[model samples]
Target: MATQPTMSEKRWLRALGATLWPSFLVAAGASIVFFANIDPETLRLDSLPGIEISRMSGYAIGFFMFWMVGLASSLLTLLLLNPTPERGPWH
Candidate 1:
């Protein structure tokens, strides 16, 4: 049987994940937006979903969208890799 991880260990891993996800994902998102040179005006995205979004706001939203996707991926990974109760052969 494998031993359970300490509480501090779990917390440290979580903190590391939290810090890494936003930093990398958000930077990637911003880079994509900049390199793509997407013009919201041309796409008529200013009034998207009835909300007024400026050029700067568009980049901000892009960052948040990337963060959200990263968060989902991170959560899925954690859920899949997290330990579950082990069943003994007798049980």
Candidate 2:
């Protein structure tokens, strides 16, 4: 038997899903499209001179970078969508 999640836990899980799932999808598509036209080695050299990065590592890094961007966008969207709680009249 499994214990049911509390309301807070449920809300946390929902927020996580909302944030991660969409970002993951966006990252996947962005990685494919971006990497298709650009060479990671060239990108790495131009962006980070003197740093040696493997193609596989570059792909991973790119994917993660895209994911982070997506996460920020999603989080901002969530924050904007949430309504501000009412405060007592103070002018």
Candidate 3:
């Protein structure tokens, strides 16, 4: 007989998968931005007009923001996905 995953195993795997997905998305986005010569510093996302930050800091902020956005979108999609119905013995 086949065995199902334990609750602890499922939770650990799920957490790893969740983290990896967002990390991969952010890494890919960073690579694309780098290749495209996009400057994160040029982005005017500051809440205060007089405030300034370094390019590295801008990139860091952008990375975290992208990861959060990707995570939320993925979670929403996952929650919306319906499971398949079970088959009957007669079918």
User: Which structure among the candidates has the greatest TM-score?
Assistant: 2
Candidate 1 lDDT, tens digit per residue, 1-91?
Answer: 9888887777767756765676567668665865388765444454465666676766666667676667676666555554564631111
Per-residue C-alpha lDDT of model 3 across residues 1-91, encoded as one tens digit per residue = 9899987677657766865687668656865676367666556454535668877786777777767777777666554543444531111
List, residue by residue over 9-80, the lDDT tens digit for candidate 2: 887788788989999999999999999999999998899978889999999999999999999998887766
| TM-scores for every predicted model | 0.55, 0.86, 0.56
lDDT at position 36, candidate 2:
98
For each candidate, the alpha-carbon lDDT, in order, equals 0.62, 0.87, 0.63
Q: In candidate 2, what residue range of length 10 has the lowest lDDT sum?
A: 82-91
**Ten contiguous residues with the weakest lDDT in model 3:** 82-91
Root mean square deviation (Cα) for candidate 3: 7.2
Clashes of 3: 0
